[model samples]
Target: MAQFLNKLIPTALAIGTGISLIDSSIYNVDGGQRAVIFDRIAGVKEKVVGEGTHFIIPWLQKPFIFDVRSTPKNIKSETGSKDLQTVNISLRVLFKPEIDKLPWIYSKLGMDYDERVLPSVGNEVLKSVVAQYDAGELITQREAVSREIREALTKRSKEFNLLLDDVSITHLSFSQDFTTAIESKQVAQQEAERSKYIVLKNEQEKKAAIIRAEGESEAAKLIIQAMASGPGFIELRRIEASKEIAETLAKSGKVTYMPNTGNVLMNMNASGK
Candidate 1:
């Protein structure tokens, strides 16, 4: 009876050990076949499935899951321009690691890609490009500045095993004194433009007035010349004036008498002679 109990105990112990081994070392990678990596290996390579359970080696081969989605990095920097004016700039960058280059990225930049590569490259390129522009140009041509920074960052990303999706400048701020000065200069420029337009308008109006005066003078001279050319012209003009006066009197329904001018002139001449 003691020998039978000893054999049963050994069998129970062996079964328990096998179950522990299977549980610890063998894992299903959400596929048909199970993956069994020994407890002494360095790493395991397998494709992970979505919405399914995955497994890894129990004690040796660790599985590090990385999200294949896009991520963003916010980069803030304070820099100076060529004119020694300080500018504050903030940028948001969207990026992702290439899935095919995951192993290289893990080996080279590790998991903290944002912490290690983003700020460094972002700051360096920002400073380098900003140093070449003055404060006024920086304020006016900010889009160009952002493009240059994006280009520089894109070029530098190859070293860090990153792909730059997009880069945008979110905000830019200048010193209080600089901003006040810029505002004042812009206002002065606008005022100057307004004054120039007013002056041009006045000049144009003056030219028109002069043209009108010249036309009136030319008309008066032509009338005088026509009168001097013929003696009957004055008599004709007086007859026309009499007709206009008669018409006006007729319209007003008033009676007008026409005096005999020839007899009055002959009596005045006889008395004088």
Candidate 2:
């Protein structure tokens, strides 16, 4: 019974070792991952694996897992504009590995593909794009800039086995002096506009005053012509003025009259005389 148990132990250990080896050789690739297989004899193979259980020759062969999902990377760069102004740029990029090119990507660029490709390519593309625009244009037309960057990246990314999902220019800024100059220029423009409004208002008022004076002159001329046309118009106007004076004086609870010779007409003996 002891001899039989000893033989069974050796067999069980051998079977357990084989099971462990098989488990180690098998790679359970998740949904978001892709794999590249390497063999000692044939070197890195062209066949890549998707989301499934894959087997590799242990010790002689290995598997490298690469995340194939959309990933975000933040980067920054500085460059000079066409106007020779210093500009700083911050970027956020969405990217992922191309599924069909996984083997070539792994073999050529390896897992640190982003580190090797994105910085240099992004730098070159950004600098080239920025060189076309001035500092002001960069701020105002940043969407164009971002679009240009993506376009350039789209073309360039193909070289590095990557698909550029998107690129965002999160923030863009300039020097303090430039900002201050812009503010000062805006303030000066506002002051100039205010001055123009004031000048316009003064001119309008002057014109109105001249128009009123001309109107008064024309009205006086018309009145003079009407008086000349009617012989009794002057006398009638004088009589109207005298009547108005008389009415005003009667309302004051007192009465007085003067003749054309300027003698006052009143009852002298009303109180004592």
Candidate 3:
């Protein structure tokens, strides 16, 4: 019985060891995940392991899993514009490792490949693209600038076995001096416009005054000529003035009497007077 027990113990121990080795060797590349094998003697393998259960030899080979999912990263940089103005820029990049290049990425950058490469390359692309545009252009042509950055960053990331799903500029700001200068410029423009308007208004007023004076002078000349011809015009003007005054008094709800004796008198006893 002791002999049988000793043999059974060794067999069970061997079986347990094998099970443990199998468990360690088997790895699952879950959804949105990929794996690369690293060999103890041969280094990283070139073949990428797809999703599902994959096996690797126990200590001789190890699996590195990577999430092949789009990730968002933010990068901020302070750079100079083409006009030599200082600008602060923020960038957002969505990126993932190329599935086919997983082996290379694992070999070179490990699991944190985006961390190792994105910020440096993102800042590089942002600085380069932003430096080509003036501060004002960055504001006016924001979409174009973002497109350029996306193109440049996409090109740059390819060299590191990365795929850029999207790239965009999230925020931008200039130095306080630049901001103040812009405000001052806008104020100056507005003041200039107001000055133009005022000048035009003054010119129009001057023209109106000249026209009024000319009209009055012409009327006086005609009146003098009429008076030289006869006193008829003066008589007619006095009658018109008297008629106008009578009409005005009538509209005022007052009673007045005009006499041919060259005098006027009001009715002292009127209703509502």
Which prediction has the highest lDDT against the true structure? Answer: 3
* TM-score on alpha carbons, each prediction: 0.67, 0.75, 0.70
lDDT for model 3, on a 0 to 1 scale? 0.90
1-273: candidate 1 lDDT, tens digit per residue: 999999999999999988887676543344232222222444434333333455544566654445556688899999999899998988899987766566555556766766888899989888898899998888799999999989998888767767889999999888999999989999999999999999999999999999999999999998899899997778988999988966676555234333675422123334456
Q: Per-residue lDDT for 19-119 in model 3, tens only?
A: 99989989899999988889999998888888999888898999989988998999899899999999999988888889999988887887888889988
Q: Please identify model 2 stretches exceeding 4 Å from their true place.
A: 1-12, 220-273
Give the whole-model CA lDDT for all candidates, comma-separated. 0.75, 0.87, 0.90
Error of 2 at 238 (Å): 15
Q: For candidate 2, which ten residues in a row score worst on lDDT?
A: 264-273
Model 3: how far residue 217 lies from native, Å: 11
Per-candidate Cα RMSD to the true structure, in Å, reads 10.8, 8.6, 5.7
Indicate the worst ten consecutive residues by lDDT in candidate 1.
Answer: 31-40
Best by TM-score: 2
Residue pairs with backbone overlap in model 1: none
